[model samples]
Target chain A: MKRYMPLFVLPTLCAFILGFILPFIMGVGLSFCKFTTVTDAKFVGFSNYIKALQDTVFRHSFWYTALFTVVSLLVINVIAFALAMALTQKMRGTNIFRTIFFMPNLIGGIVLGYIWQLIFNGILAKYSTALALNEWYGFWGLIILVSWQQIGYMMIIYIAGLQAIPGDVLEAAQIDGATGWQRLWKVTVPMMMPSITICSFLSVTNGFKLFDQNLSLTAGEPGKMSEMMALNIYNTFYGRTGWEGVGQAKAVLFFILVVIIGVLQLRATRSKEVQQ
Target chain B: MKKKKVMPVLLAAAMTVGMFAGCGSNDAGTAGGSTQGAQGTQAADKSSGDGSVYYLNFKPEADEQWQILASEYTKETGVPVTVLTAASGEYEKTLKSEMAKTDAPTLFQVNGPVGLASWKDYCYDLSGADVTGQLTSEDFALKDGDQTLGIGYVIESYGIIYNKALLEKAGYTAADITNFASLKKVAEDITARKDELGFSAFTSAGMDGSSDWRFKTHLANLPIYYEYKADGIDNTDAIKGTYLDNYRQIWDLYINNATCDPKLLSTKTGDDAVAEFATEEAVFYQNGTWAYNDVKDLGDDNLGLLPIYIGVDGEENQGICTGTENYWCVNKNAAPEDIQATLDFMNWCVTSETGVNAMCKDMGFVIPFKSNLDSENVLVNAANDYLDAGKTPVTWNFTTMPSEEWKNGVGSALTAYAADQSDANWDAVKKAFVEGWATEAAAAK
Candidate 1:
């Protein structure tokens, strides 16, 4: 089996190299060069990186992305966990409720963004305001949109984790004079650490990576105030004529930030997970 | 272990199959290449009649007409023409990606000088091309040194599009408005009598992505045009903004007299403004000849084009801001055969009757070519009326606007001012306009 393992992994290994590694290497290489096209790229060294740092919009988008990620992670996980806990208990029409809660996740991101934009604009119109009128409006609108789209997905994961826990452990805790709140905080939550880690990681990364929703909803309106890291990088690449290298540099930085934060979060949460 | 061995084999076979499946599609693309053509001319050997043309069209509004025209040409000439229209506001991005493909677009567009500057290397010099001779004048051609990089395909004019019935009901006529003072009086009176008259002075100046160009690109042209004129120059590296005060005056009047709130301007879209004008909720809408089709249902007699009176001196003699941003530029990188075919096809489009009709009627375009002499669009006719009167046409100097980044910066500043209507905000807008221009120009260089 060990001798055959290499053969079994070869296909996937080839695919991973072709699809991810090659492009990533090329992307990193391109970050150091300046050219309209790949064939014409000339090495310009750290100038692109310097430009990315100097860009006020790029810096603003970093902070915006960080704030969005933190807020969305907290909001999404809390609500999703609550919904999952409720659904996991013996309840009427639990399947229907689960399906209903998860339906938004099925819709495409662009479609969700547009649908939410119309809904938000309709509501804001009453106050003689709109989603694009203010960055805060755009920010909250995105958080609401992301939560609506992702809560169901996180809830399902949480429900799976909840169901996986032994019933006897919970029953024993209850029998030992444990209150509902105490059992939830001490046993259930500690037991749900794995689920929390996954959900938090997903929501946090999703928040940072958000683009279509941000674009369709506000498109950095009220003057690029609501532009996130991904959107900022995209705008730099396509919107600015000569900033392709700088955009690539920003993208590399974004990739590093996401990876670091994702790893840190995994470590922080993984350490707290109880051994089965 | 046996099952695992079989599974790996199956997965590897599936992967091989998928690779072959992708290859199968590429084979189809080449085999079907006979049918998938563009602008009708890219084949190296023209006598074989296998020449195909791929035109990446810029105007989203004219896309349908272009598609119909391409098919019609293919049917007549036994040549295939493939027309791909980029969504509005995404042409540059689309062109960049498409041009990198093996079968790049033989025909594309450069908006103007600033756009030409970016794509100049790819542009096939049209100086000696067949279409060059067919041009009414070389004045509309964009020249980078000795090379004619692009030629204006259409001439458009933007001003105050007024609903005639609403204006007449307000007890005013076209004759009443000749300058800023008169235009102001009528708009202010109509606004003041809004309760009685049931219509406001102007439609909402939407600052949304779709409509911001109306203000940021077109309306902003008024100041740029005047400043260029006053400075006795056609284009400049850095604008002094001599007429920004006049720009502020017109913008203020627009917001103050409109039915919609100034703070709500950011939310109002171009469609909403069109609806307002079409439904007669407002008398004035600041748009261009392109909007003629959208508002034509209001009846020709009911619609009129007036100069955007921004209180510039000797402005009574000023015509509507007139010129074109769209220019046809052939890809220099394409094969010579494709280039020649593109040039021939471009000539045929302007010279042929079918092409002329489509441009003037379906697209509502005032083609700059000598072949298309007349246009039926009322706004176009109105523009001609201004030209015939010897009024100086405000050349679209905004074509030289440093870049989209600068335009966005200015747009943001303008929106902030529109929202707050403060002196400090106006100053910020001024700074974005003046200093931002120099900054962007330097960056572009």
Candidate 2:
């Protein structure tokens, strides 16, 4: 088995180098240059990073994305957990309810955004305003849209975690005069830490990396007040002329920020896991 | 046991090798197939060899006609002409990627001077070319120093398109409105009688992304044009916004007497406005000659254009805003033979009888070429009438707009203002127009 390891690993290693590592290295290099095309790049030191940091719009998007990530992470996880718990209980038609709840996750992000836009606009029309007219409206609109699309996906993960809990452990807790709430917190939750870690990591990263839904829903309208970091980076790269390097620099910073947050979240959640 | 272990190892090796072979064969198959297809086409007609034309067309509306024209050219000259039209609003991005390819576009388009700046390095000098000679005026040719970089192909005009019968029914005629004052009077009267008339004065001034360009860029051009006219300049680094107050009045009139509430305009699309004009729910729609196909079902006589009157001094002489953003540029990076072929093809497009008719009659373009044919488009004829009447056509200054971000900023501000219609909101629009422009202009530098 050890002798065949190199042969099996070679293909995946080559693919990773070609697809991810090479482009990532190139991206980091390009962030320090002024260029319209890669071939015409000229070294420009830290000017691009300076410009990216100095941009008020970019700073605003940073804070906006941070708040959005935190709120959406909490909302999606809580609702998903609740739904997972409910569906796991002994009940008829649980499969049907789960499938129905999970349907939105199957739809493309752009399609979901437009569908929700029509629905939201239809309801908001009675108030004589629209989702694109105000910043807060766009923010909350994105929250509702993302939650609607992502909650079911998280719910599936939570359900798997709930099902993986040993029945005997809960029975033991019940025989020991433990209440349902005590059993859930002391036994079920600590055992569910690994799944919680994965779920939180996914939700947080997804919240920060969101682009297509943000674009199709509002497109950072009402003076780009709702522009997230990814969309802002995209706009900087594509929308503005001569801002490609700054966009690349923003992307690098965004990558670092997400990594730090994800690592910290994983570490915090992993510590709470108890052995069965 | 050794034989069993060796059999599994061999199987694993075979599977891994098969995976690689699968990917390799797939790529090779597609590449070989494409080359074979190209060879098949080339073998069909072997004349006019070594100089195929590849035009990266900018306009999606004219794509089908361009394809027909390309095939026609190919049949006659036996030069393979490939026409690839970028999706609407994706031309710049497409052009950038395409230009980097080995077989880059031999022919492409630039919007105006601002568009030419980035592509200027790639543009072949059209000086002394037959196509440059065929241009109606030097103004239609975009030049940098001594070299002609691009030539304007089409001249489009936009104004207030009105329903002729509806105007007469409201006790008004095209001749009754000469300036902003009379236009305002007639529009206000129609609004006053809107309950009895069963139709509003103007179509909804939609602020959706699809519709907002009519206001943010085209409508915004009026103020920019007037400012330039006042400044006695063709281009400027910063705009003083001298005619913004007049801009305010025209915008206010459009929203106040429209088919829908001002607040509801944010969700209204271009199609909604066209539907309103087409169904006779509104009398006036703010659009251009390109809208002829959309509303021509109403008949030629029913369609008439009025120059957008934004209440300026001596403004009765203000003709429709007329200019071309579509300028054909030859790629300097292409092979010499391909360059000549592209040049010859362009000259033939404006010169040959089949080319002129296809462009004018079939495509509905008012091409700015000496050998251009008469267009049957009524809105185009109306625009020519204004020019013939000696009214000064407002040039398209929006082409000089610093960036798309500036346009989006203005559009967003305009959308917000339309929803609330407050003084503070209007101030924000002005700030977006003025400060946003300055910021973008500086950033572009």
Candidate 3:
């Protein structure tokens, strides 16, 4: 065990420090500094955080992201579960259909954004309006894009949960004269809680982390009406001069929000899981 | 039982330490590699040890030329050159990130005054070089006090480039568009039969990166041109914008009479509009001579450039949009050798006949150089004619500094007006324009 300890634990520790710990420390320090490069940072503490908290764009992004995540979370989980339930049943070419449905997730975010942009603009062309510069078009466009990309991935997870339920549970409910829907509600659903919990957690976290697609698709057109948290932080940091600290503050706030929401989601979902 | 239980915990502890050590090592390696690369860049020619030239290209159109130029320079000098071209519109942000590297490009472009100002602190000086003398004066030079930070490798001008064949085909000549009213009347007539002629009056007047040059700088010239003339001097940043109402006349005329759907203008660029003109779908495209390469293949004999006279008074004598572009400056941070090389290169480009001819051949450029700027190049010749005709040339007075706030602020306001043609939006545009200019001009550090 001692001999192999370095081999096994070394990679993860390195990953933590390199990917998370180091950058995190640097980022926190940067939130107080006003400068272009990290090394050249000039300490002007609290002002960056104050400005970040006060920014209308940052505040707007928080609300926008929250709304988007809630809406997408519900829609994605529902569609995924419905598809999972149907696919888990006896059916021909279920794997093929699953593969087909899940394929959208394989495409890169920037490419998906551009493809969706073309599709949206094509549809809007007949109406004599465009998706390129409008705000609502950007929001709905992101919604459609995210749902199309994530539903299949969540559906796969849901299928794993649905398949794990004991046949005896459903059989016992049937013997007790339960209707089909009743049996599903009493036996299958209760047993599928673990899968439902995990999928919900994943989709919710993913909604918070979203960036590339939002950037490529609309870039929050028509005065940033569709700007999300990640895009807002990026633009604030790089687009505005001397706003690095403010951008860093937004990032720290973002980290706190995601961590809180993620942990809360995990706890809530985990509590619903059946012992089995 | 105790030994067994403790095995995983012991293993995990060891793993954690190893992990941190491994990461620390990697960071040290990266930092070391960066330092070495920086040292190489600062070294002259042979000692650079895999040191190569990296260029972050803003013009996608110049990708081919850069590839050729880079390859030629490498073959000529035996210096390794790596050219990374930013697909158009990605230059500023990409360059910002790229410039922070330990192995930043030693030979990248310093395009304009605003661009120079943005990265002035990083440039190497080229002041006493032979290339410094090639310039007409300090007019095209960008300096940080005594240091010549950027040298114009090649300069360009923008105006209204027209399809003379289409004009002749429509029973008119390039000579006909002498005044604002004449230009407007002809454009409307041509646009009325856009189907028969298979063209329209103008291309998409979008306000994004490509097309905003038309609005923020070019089309706004009606107001600025008048302001420049009103004062009977050069470089007027102040404008009444009362004539901005007349600006709406030309703006409305261009937007309504254009071949493109205006709603898509937010995404359209000068490149897209020029593409339309090149394909002969639009009779007129507003852009700089930088666009000459894209259109030159259509045959220079058929292509004609008219001076921008959106609707200014005394418009008959107005010449093409007269301005300077793509100025070069040296880095204040460069080592003595690099500074010398940069100086040497600049002098070589301006004074050496080989350098000027090569620049002209590839760039089709108008140099500020007295000797070299005299070219068989008709575009440069025509630009000179505009200057010689005593027409007050409109410079890019707004770009005295590169402010993202000013660029996007002007763009945002112009975008709203382009959509609805509301006087309120125009007023908003003017407010954004004036206030943004005032703020940026004042805030420049």
Candidate 4:
């Protein structure tokens, strides 16, 4: 198998180098240069990085993305876990409930954003305000939208974890006079650590990487207040002429932030996992 | 074990076959493209053409007409003319990518002075070009020092597009709206009788991405235009808030007389605004000549353009905001043959019957070049009437707006102000305009 590994790995290695590694290197190089096109790039040192740091909107988006990630992680995992536990119980027609809950995940993000925008505006119109009226409105709107779209997916993972918990453990706890609540806290939760880790990591990264929904929702209306890190970088790249290098620098910073957070989260979660 | 061996062999065979197939198809595709190119050159060669014309048109709305014009020119003269239109609002990004290619466009568009500054390095001097000679007035030519960089293609105007029947029913006419005070009275009276007349004074000037440009870019032009006039300058490095009072007056009138609440403006859209005007739910809609096709069914006799009578001194001299931002620039970096081909194509567009008819009739453009055909666009006619009446048409200096980033900042500020109409909020909007412009200009430099 080891001898044949090179043949199997060659195709994927070639694709990764061509598709991801080359472009990523080029993009990193561009962050240090000033040019309209790659062919005309002129090295400009750290000026782009300096300009990117000076951008108030870019700084605001960093804190906004951090808060959003923490909030989304808590909300999505809690709701999804609750749903997963409830659905795992011997209830009539649990499949139908699960299917209905998960259906929103199938819709495209842009389409979902527009549909929710109309719904939000319709309700807000009664109060004579709108989604773009306030940054908090857009923030909360995005939270609800992302939670609605992702909860079912996380719930599926949690359900699988719940069912995998050995029946003998629950029976043994019952024989020892352990209550339902005690059994859940001691046995079920310990076993579900892996699922919780996966779900939380996913929601956190999704929160940070959000773009299309942010754009279609508020598009940083009310003075760029609700712009996430991705949208801010995009707007800087295309909206501000001659600032493409700074935008690229912002993108590189965003990539580093996401990578650091992801690795830290994985390590923290892995530490809490029980042997089971 | 047998399955694994067989699968690997099959995969290898499939990969070899796929490689061969890919090579074959690439050869075929290139073969077809070169033949088309050869045919195009043959046609150009027959008609004293030196090179083929590759036009990167900016307007998506007129894409069909441009495609027809390209094909027609190719058929007539055997010159290979290709027209590729970028989606609206994506022209700058598209042009940036396309200009990096080997076969870059011979012809492209610049919004006005600001756009010219960005592309000045690539712009061919049209001072001695035949197309420059065909231009009706040299005033429409965009100059960089002694070099003619771009020539205006079409002149368009925008203002308060009112329903003539609705205005008459309210006991008002276009002549009554000579100033801000009179225009306000007419809109107020009509809005006061909205229930009886079955139409309000103004359509919803939505602050959504689609509709906000009407206010942010066009309506904002009123104050910018007056300030430029007062300062005796065509462009400025930084603007003082001299005409913001007039801007506020006009904005206040628009929001107060509209069919939707100011808070709800963020939810509304340009399409909704157009629908309200088309369905006669509103008496006034703020838009430009391009909207003629959308609202012409309201009847040519019943539709007219009125000056945006923001309370400025000498308001009677104001006409509809009329100017050309759509200027054509040939690429100097292109091969000389291609440049000459582009020049010839532009001259033919102005002087030839087919090109003139396509631009004036099919696309509803009021060409600034010396074309014989009269434009059939009713909005153009309305603008021409204002010019004949000796009204000084307000120039669209918004084209020279510092940057798109500045526009977005102002747009966001405007939306915020619309949501909460207060002195503090308006100050923020004003700051975003004045300060944002300075910041963007410095950044652009």
Which regions in candidate 4 have their CA more than 4 angstroms from the true location?
A1-7, B1-51
Clashing pairs in 4: B43-B78, B44-B78
Provide the lowest-lDDT 10-residue window in model 2 chain A.
A34-43
TM-scores of the candidates in the order shown? 0.93, 0.93, 0.86, 0.93
Kindly list the interface RMSD, in angstroms, of each predicted candidate in the order they appear: 2.2, 2.6, 4.2, 2.5
Candidate 1: RMSD to truth = 3.4
RMSD of each: 3.4, 3.6, 5.3, 3.9
Clashing pairs in 1: B37-B81, B37-B82, B38-B53, B38-B54, B38-B81, B38-B82, B42-B52, B43-B51
Candidate 3 docks at the CAPRI level of: acceptable
- Cα lDDT for residue B368, candidate 3: 73
Candidate 2 falls in which docking quality class?
Answer: medium
User: By summed lDDT, which 10 consecutive residues of candidate 2 chain B come out lowest?
Assistant: B28-37
Candidate 4 structure quality by residue, lDDT tens digits, B96-182: 776877767789998899888778888999998888998888889999899999999988899889899988888888888889999
- Over B302-370, each residue of candidate 1 has an lDDT whose tens digit, in order, gives 888999989987999999888888899998998777787678778878999998888877887888888
lDDT of 2 by residue, B100-193 (tens): 6666778989999888876788899999999999888999999899899999999999999999999999999999999999999999999999
Q: How far does residue A234 in candidate 3 sit from its true spot (Å)?
A: 2.3
Report the C-alpha lDDT of model 4 over A1-276, residue by residue, as the tens digit: 577667666655665776699989999999999877555678999999999999988999899888988989999999999999999999899999999989999988899889999999999989888898789999999999999999999999999999988899899999999999999899889889999899988988999999988999888877789999999999988776678888999999999999999999999998889986
Fraction of native Cα contacts reproduced by each candidate: 0.48, 0.51, 0.27, 0.63
* lDDT tens digits by residue: candidate 1, A1-276: 577677667766776887799979988999999867554577999999998999998899989889999999999999999999999889899999999999999999888888898898888878877777689999999999999999999999999999999999999999999999999999999999999999999988898899998888888977789999998999888765677888899999999999999999999999999987
**Backbone clashes, each candidate:** 8, 0, 22, 2
